[model samples]
Target: MSFGPPPSLYTQSSVAADQRRRKRRRTVLLCAVAAVVAPALAVGAWLWWPGTASDDAKPTAAPAQHRLDVRETVERRPASTQGVMAVRLSTDDLPPGEAHEMPGLWATDKILAKGINRTLVGVAIGTDAGLGEEAWKLRLGGPICGKTRHVTVENRTAVLFRDSADKESLCNHVAFVDLDDGKLVWQAEFPVSGYVDKPDAGSQWDPGVTLTHATVTVTWGDGTDAYDMDRGKLRWRVTSREDCISQGAGGGRALAVRFRCYDADDPQSRSTFEIRALDPRTGRSRWTYTPAVGVKDVRIISTTPTVLATSAGDVGITEIISLDARGKYRTTIPLQGGAYVAECTDEITYLATEECPSLAVGAGQVFLTSKEQGDLIHNANWIIGFDLKTGHSVKKFESGPNTLLRPLRMSGDRLLALRESSDRISPMALVSLNPRTGAETPYFYFSLPQEGELFSTTEFADTVVQNGRLFFGAKEAQGPADADSKAWVWLAFGIESAAAKKP
Candidate 1:
């Protein structure tokens, strides 16, 4: 086809190449415009959206001016022959008791730390003549076969204890007393049945509390109830057969409850869970939701009028369920490996796993521990972070393997991780980890002596943080074979305000 107009094959080929080039250029230009316009459109839509509290909520103000000031470390040693069980702090200065003998038991002198210009309160039990009787007799409530189940402070006026003396009693009883005068305020017995074997039914044992506008929502064995603290009147009660009851308070009148219902026969039956919301004043149900099943040990990690239920399923599956204000299911997220869900905030949820503890939200980040897993013989434990909004892991920090991770405490931006190790002979260390960056700082580390063979026992009275100061108390063993080895010491540490900074 070398005809005159054959237009050299080369020329034709060149023309086709030119057309291809133009098409590509046009495509590039269009792509460039789309890229530049799409983001702009999104920004415009976001800015134009009506301003709602959920959208325009102001950023949390920086933690008020505060410091982690080490205020005091009191070493309280009981008398020579006495063993202390529970120690409590009161407003007045009380005399220490001397060891004495009673009808069938030995008693020691009672010791009370008083006259501290703080709302600090502590309680301890002792074994000896004078002290033991005084300590045990204080009886906020209980000969509770097990340790006291719950202790709550009420406006510095009274301390409430929920304890059980006999297995026949289904409901846990409550006792209130003046913190300053040690005067009994009021006591009431609640009956719980259905879950446990006992005469009293419907009363809760391990009751959780959330106060809203003078109303306290108590979650316990059989259901959720609201009480008016000021009037000391029962407002209303809702019955459900869930095992563990947890409550979260937010805003002024909103409250959320995490109800756990498990199958007695099938461990996997533990998956049944529900998060309910109600009006704190009227006790009217606002919303209810059944999150996905397949997990047991479901707990209320945290909430904001919203409920976040985290469950540890069979094998190594962990799931997080978010319920909206209407108690409707918002989303379900499956965590890699299995995780022990701790606390959840508006921003993130903290998780701990067996192999590696890390945070997730967008990208998974691992937290580094001061000690290595290999060094601890694969005992190193990690505290992982997960972003609440994105459903991805964010960071992981090392919380030593021997350490028992307590609940996550939020102070401003800093997330507090409390861990205790009972492996050591004396006292255990209370470590504080930065949840955001996975950096850990030791808060208090001490130990008490054991009665025989030094079987590494450490007891933490309470971990409370107020006004930027962390108050941790530990019971140190007096000495080997000494029943009096259970004296307590309260350590107050002023954490660097920076420790509270969010990651």
Candidate 2:
């Protein structure tokens, strides 16, 4: 989606250029200072001390203090759920054309970064009483094909995009971007053999990327490559075998690959799936786990805990499998009989192998949302937690009628849930769910714009919480279904407050 900034905001390109110029000036000044001090430092002299003063007489500079951002302070003193709109981005800002798929959402202390159509954009996260403005934009050469939901501790992430704008172009380019300043730190292209025109064709698979603390992994159907996150240098490569095709990879605390193999000579033989864990640095196999004969598809829920979602005869996910750190089977939570909702795929497109947005695995529990229960007038769901060891339901958090709760991610040890807006009346909320008691503590509550109805359901949207705010955005931005009808579509929005001060 092409987004135009509001009247109150500056264009991202201009702001980014100005920031770059200032950074260059600072670099030059620092270099000049070092040059001036070079000769004095070679004399074995204490430059800052008085004549003949001993080395021990020199005073040591104090260490820099660490300052907390707005988001950090909010965590210390829980932000009021009663929040006002901080920023609202709408698709209506630009002329409507073909629908665009938006994929990635991330936040830093001062800005919220998102992948919109082909461009990565950042907007200021305004205070409780103001609206955030556009900060910067980094335009990729082509639409983003895949991205890593994992952000490094220093706030860096990776993205995969095509070499050109042509729809049939191969998604061969991978890059690491600095989320803080919207800068492309490094980018490199990989050899890809496939067809973007036919993603379902046997030749098409890769086009995926994932991140660990030190490595950025990218897969393009036929092979997988790992790169140094800082320098974009290739660390290792794994190619597909004649019988087993490399699907893709997932990474966070650990790295794993999904593969499919079949007997080419036996036409009636069934194809099998395998999950293989790899050493993030060297691409060496750590262990491999094979599912039941009938399991058709497998997805990674968490690499640290080694949790997976698998599908059998049906199209939807059938089981949630949890494995130990050593890849041993620990438990299987069944989803049959419509008892739970852990969908890994949608009608339009397949999510990344590890991008099960609604499901969370942490704190010795695999948390999932129960299927919505109620009639048209009222509907609700439960955030159910299943023990990773026993596969038994242990904790549950319920929502009120007309309200739905979905797990976003784990915050420290607590699971964070999004309390979706209800019937256009009750405002949406961000709540912290206690892992032990299933009790909730509100982080904040805020409503979206009328054009933001698309965010009501996060199934197809990306939701991220950082600092102390919640950012919810649409994955698909399109015009009204009917060409003749007119409807304002919102691209994304943010909720935050400066009013919640430390008590």
Model 1 weakest lDDT span, ten residues long: 1-10
Over the stretch 57-91, how does candidate 2's per-residue lDDT look in tens digits?
11222223222100111232243335544555542
lDDT of 2: 0.67
Q: Which stretches of candidate 1 lie over 4 Å from their true place?
A: 1-138, 144-168, 176-185, 195-213, 219-223, 239-254, 260-271, 305-309, 312-317, 330-335, 339-372, 375-382, 396-408, 418-462, 467-503
**What TM-scores do the predictions have?**
0.50, 0.79
lDDT of 1 by residue, 245-266 (tens): 3322222234666665666577
Candidate 1, residue 295: how far the Cα is off, in Å: 3.6
* C-alpha lDDT of residue 378 in model 2: 73
